[model samples]
Target chain A: MDLHLGRITWFQGGRDKVAREEVKSLEVYETGPTLTFSMGPQHPGTGHFRMVITVVGDIVVRCDPDPGFVHRGEEKMCEYKTWITNIPHLERPAILDAAGMTYPYVLAVERLMGVEPPERAKYLRVIMAELQRICSHLYWLGLMGVFAGHATMYMWCFGDREYLVDLTQLIGGQRITHSYFVPGGVRNDAPSKVPRELVKNFRTYYRMMLGKDYPSGEVPEDFRKYVLAVCDFFDTRLDEYYPMLLDSPIFIYRTKGIGVLKREDAISLGVVGPVLRGSGVKSDTRIDEPYDAYPYIKFNVPTMDGCDSYSRMMVGYYEMKESVRIIKQAVEQMPEGPVKLKQHPVTIKVPAGEVFASAEAARGQCSFYIRSDGTDKPYRVKICSPSFRNLIAMPYLIKDVRIADIPIIYWSLNYWPVECDR
Target chain B: MSLSKAEEILKRLIEDLRSRFGDRVLEVNVEPKKIVKILVALECIKDVAQYLKSEWAIDYIKGVTGVDLSKLPNNAQEALEIIYHVGSLSSEALKGITISLSTKVSISNPVMPSLTGIWKGAEMHEREVYEMLGVSFEGHPDLRRLLLPEFWSDGPPLRKNYMVPGREGQSG
Candidate 1:
């Protein structure tokens, strides 16, 4: 048996290394460098994800990602449920990117049945998707910060994330699994004051952090002092974190040259969204393959040629900022229209054909390939998740990096185990 | 970039494949249908896939879906048919294709050739098939349970024989 990293690859020859080598020699071209080791099914910093790693000395020789540990078999289960019922079903893959994942599934169904959502609904989906993007990046930043041992950043990122989660709950009446996105449109429109609340929350969050002289007259002195202290702590931590991560010799040494996936390699591997962009390939499903309201939005697809863990991490940071920009654009361009298409309940019958729809999910491009036999329910639904493709590239990336940097590399990838394992 | 050129190219390629491998080419009707269905025999899966990749640059293996045909089986020995939906990233015009292949193995003890050797993307999909359908891949390196845990004794839950009801917290 050949074990790569901590994940099992191929149990080839019997327990004899010599026999394995002899057999391996016959398949000369396919013979990858012999590196043997275990990474994890459970380990801190790998997030909820753990992969057994194998390295030939300092280089990753092979990586086999052990999935199914968190497998819920979401696709098969969706088959048993009605079209409307599966709204919650699709959201479970990446809890942070619920709306982004759900939107494509909804769009595929709607597109198949030729159902058009109202103008307000389109604007609403964009708002929710962008909000979800921000929230997803916050989770990634928090996880990345925690893995980097920056507890302060983790707390701040997650704390700031709560503000957005609160906004989501206000819109959908739920936080994480906001089954708000349904076929044809959103399940419910945001309340008239909901936008006001959203703007207020953004102001409160921004004033607490980004403002120079944060409206001190608007609040009491003691409360002002407390906010200042919390802000100071996070501001100081952010100041130290960037230089420590990007400029420090030790940190740079670990991240600078680790997990290098080139541009062509990324594209050919079907590595989508930011992972491909991080490798200097300006390929975003939103920009290159525009869908939803993204075609109207203007944002740069950030790219870096470094292709290492640090580059990937930097890519995420910049992309998060871009997502914010998108949200702001979407909000500013909001127009007056009904938020949902008028339709009879249980009357949607999708055409008897498979529709492959993809969206720019936070991690990468998550593509949903749905097969419907002209029915309300899908004949078969196959989700080609971003993490699955990104996970496959681990062997190539983690080849020679030290076991100590394994968690760091994995964290920098921003991989979700549930997403990958699904 | 003209329509006829693409069609002519496909026509010439089909003729070559038909001549090279006789009746093994079950069907090669590649008209611009909604779903690009390429029906081929079990034995010619690897060959036809290579042809698709080399000639058409159908590189991206989009999704692998397994259909349980045990109830519709004319023979008990007939294996479940698996569909490999291949997508080409480079070809903007021709985005995705559905290639259906069938093999008759056994219901009691099912086994099929592993396509992981040809399409590296099918590794997870094959593991899924093995776990859900009980169709063992002959030369698959790691043929363990995928979605289900190692302890779960429920025999290949997706099989027609198995009664997979609406269980609580079963991911729905």
Candidate 2:
């Protein structure tokens, strides 16, 4: 048997026309060069996002992250809703860090309304925001671990996150999408008395989870013990978590040098949160633009110079510890007063002005630019979410990376599709 | 940093901008410390933005918002106002400062120079603005529909005149 490869020539007009000869050449190849495919919009790796990637063999040559699957016309819809009602809607975008996400909008609206929350309210806001930050970071860590094929890490992070979530529920009535932030202050104060047994159990379980101990007699009585226990639990977990991931050869090999974003490129790409800090940029809105009780509380901004996936994961780990420290400090320094202002949520009118308020959220700098035209509702509200800013880095980091490394690189940026789409 | 320090730096930056642009700078409002809103001509936005980035190191764009000014009394010309929230990460002193460079384009013909060339971060933002407000960024590399679908035939949804489906008969 004879097999013909490459081009096949067919004669046109057959045997009838002997004098006229026509050739139709059809070209075929045994091997193709590159394949272009869509990875998301429904894929487990990408949540509510579609990325079209051109891959040559196993290496991704180009990647285009198509977001907006969850776009609910949030900015446009804010104009139709009252300022206070917008909080619940806004928090839905970044559900994991509900307090942190809504804090900036409240701050901006408060600035426009020329109303300042009381000292106690500000401190409460800080505590709630920090707790939400820890919860958000844990969610990211669990998702990251699961994406990287470490099922145990996911279980541990998600299990540990419940303590923080429970604390948030104690402060705010809801678990996620807590519309706790109001224009002037938070919705409610911490319950007059949190069950001491619950706090003690959280402390004990968290300590055992990480195999560490806290100094006795250092923690004060009352609510301080609960806050201190949270701090101690996270502090111990950071040590254990960091060593487990960083020391593991497999983890190191998969993440250490992969998805490297240079410090300059990180800034240019508008990378934020752990992704930015991982690239050695010490820019945190909490420190740079101090709001609420951030100025009063003292906590280190964890940064790593590695500019890689490993460093980004490390930043997330250290940040959880820092968030616990911030919560503890805020709790210790909290003043005694009313948590909410006299202003009603439904009828609050803001003067005609524009205010850009930013809060250092778990993901990054979540900012709200509100323009009030002397109305109860906002004229225009622009939310520059951290996930939206980090979307720019997707194509840049994924270039020339292996298909297997896609999940690690994507999750390392901590890109939340819902938030970005909003 | 204290408000006074931020104000002083902002004052210095405004003075620099005034000297550089002269009459081209329409208005400068620095009432809110750490936020300087500069209203400039459409043509000079690129020059002003390039100066801010190269000289003061305002590297990243926090956001680009397009405000429909048809209903507002301040915008008598019935123009669409584009605001660029420019920020910095390189300089510690300027990190807190958010210089919002705003420019107005006539409602009939809304077109302005794109800042994507100066700051690559503004690429998606410009696209969003382009799709939402129907304002064209002249030199934008990819000024296509960002959030909205290609099949979307209605005018810019964020514009004041663009009525929602259920609220078509209602008056503003």
Candidate 3:
């Protein structure tokens, strides 16, 4: 009769024993023709994650989300590597939002080393972070569409995301896992010049977004204008998704009132980012704890009162636009200076101290608690990933829902296995 | 940037903690301005956690981390430090204040009371701590290996004593 009764054993050798024990505990297990099977990693709906749910007459009664399929022991690995080398491995956890993943770690290490990065480096960090947020949200949007059976929405999102991914490659020198951030500052500075032909194609749009009237011949080398043009384009392009997916009848029917997380429950469970915002809370680590240029940058924390799958979808959707706004503001306000510290990042040994820094990643707040022992390496690096925190809410939300409605509920929580397991 | 507003809350938080906890609160260290670390006794961890949740509106725990000071190049005492990174979401006054409610326990019998009752979100985090650090949370409902495989019988991997496989000869 209790929710927190016992551990759900991974159905291995003694399948019948697991089923029988489950039968004794749950009414669904006791009922006629009950099904006890894992919606495992191989499934399209569940991305390298599993939820062993027990069902009776199409209603899921018990859900035990089994993650850790991609467990690489990321934190353990951090101890062995130098602070500079840890970036590559740490960023791998959440590759989609690599800058966001490693930002807090870099911040902690920077504090430990007692070397503040330049003002330009800080602004560049903000720009890269927002770009990564846009890319991650696009990837998520594509997945949400496919899960809801809107194939066109998936195609459109994936295709459009490539543009941002290219922009990432241009800056970070990598597409997915950009190990661009270091303890001192960034590994490299964002490009100073933009391609002539690229901007020439969208010259009018660039002019309007940048608010300059020059009879274009040479296609201004202003990378800020190029970035702002892309941001403005995305800000306008986001409106198209409303008609394509949000306003659709099937999308509304599936998500409008489904997977409704209450405001109280959201706070108590410690869910972050869009899921928290979707439930009517404006608690963003970017706003709460201003890191890098977040304090200087002006943007709104979007909150939705719907508190359902649709609201979560809307929250993430609006966040993409807000991210664009942050990028534009950061790009325009960025000053000229050296991006990295004068001291070599590789040679620096941190003093003995403990510090924790958290940043608002694409999904939620990704935090790092670093305890350095006056050495090149860390004593303990505790990574509190948002996916891991959000994973606890799976069983709480997945209960008492139809088996068909499982994917929508699970995806709405934004649980990525690698990030959660790492 | 409202950080000053958050600082006022932190000062009040420290004052309230001292008034309530007294000598049980061993130390209170604020890293720069945002993070507050409070060291307390192992026996009163659950009570202190409950008090923080109810009184300070610090309902959610960001994480539960266990650090083995036994392996550190420190002085006499051998102990495992359990740090609970708690923060607020319900009350705006307490927002952005990252409170580390930490306690030290003997390494041989690394056990502490679970805060899952106080913060239900701590269930998985406590489980991870149990598996990784071998620190038993006495009242944890389901204390099984979370991220680790079932075959992992070797002592908790995160401890400094247990050398990570290939990292033995490396400069860690």
DockQ (0 to 1) for model 1: 0.18
Total backbone clashes of model 1?
Answer: 17
RMSD, model 1, all Cα superposed?
7.7
**DockQ, ranked from best to worst:** 3, 2, 1
TM-score, cand. 3 vs. native: 0.91
Local distance difference test, per candidate? 0.64, 0.81, 0.81
Candidate 3, residues B95-141: lDDT per residue as tens digits?
A: 77789999998877677788889988898998888768777777777
Q: Please provide, for model 1 over A1-422, each residue's C-alpha lDDT reduced to its tens digit, 9 standing for 90 to 100.
A: 24321232222222123234533432243425755545556566665554655566676655666566788877777666767778787889888889877877887777666777777677778768877877787777677666666566677778777766766776677887888877777788775443445444545765766655435433222322332333333344345546644565555666777778876666555565667777886666676456667777898878888987878877876776676667666666767777777643754566666566667788887777676665666656767777876776666677666777777777777778888766
For DockQ, candidate 1 versus 3, the one ahead is 3
Error of 3 at B90 (Å): 2.0
Off by over 4 Å in 1: A1-40, A53-63, A194-204, A211-251, A343-351, A374-376, B1-35, B69-79, B90-112, B138-142, B165-172
lDDT, candidate 2, B33-146, per-residue tens: 324799998889999999999999999789988988887646445888899998899988887778889999987777788998998989888888877887778778765556
Better of 1 and 2 by TM-score: 2
Work out the TM-score per prediction.
0.77, 0.91, 0.91
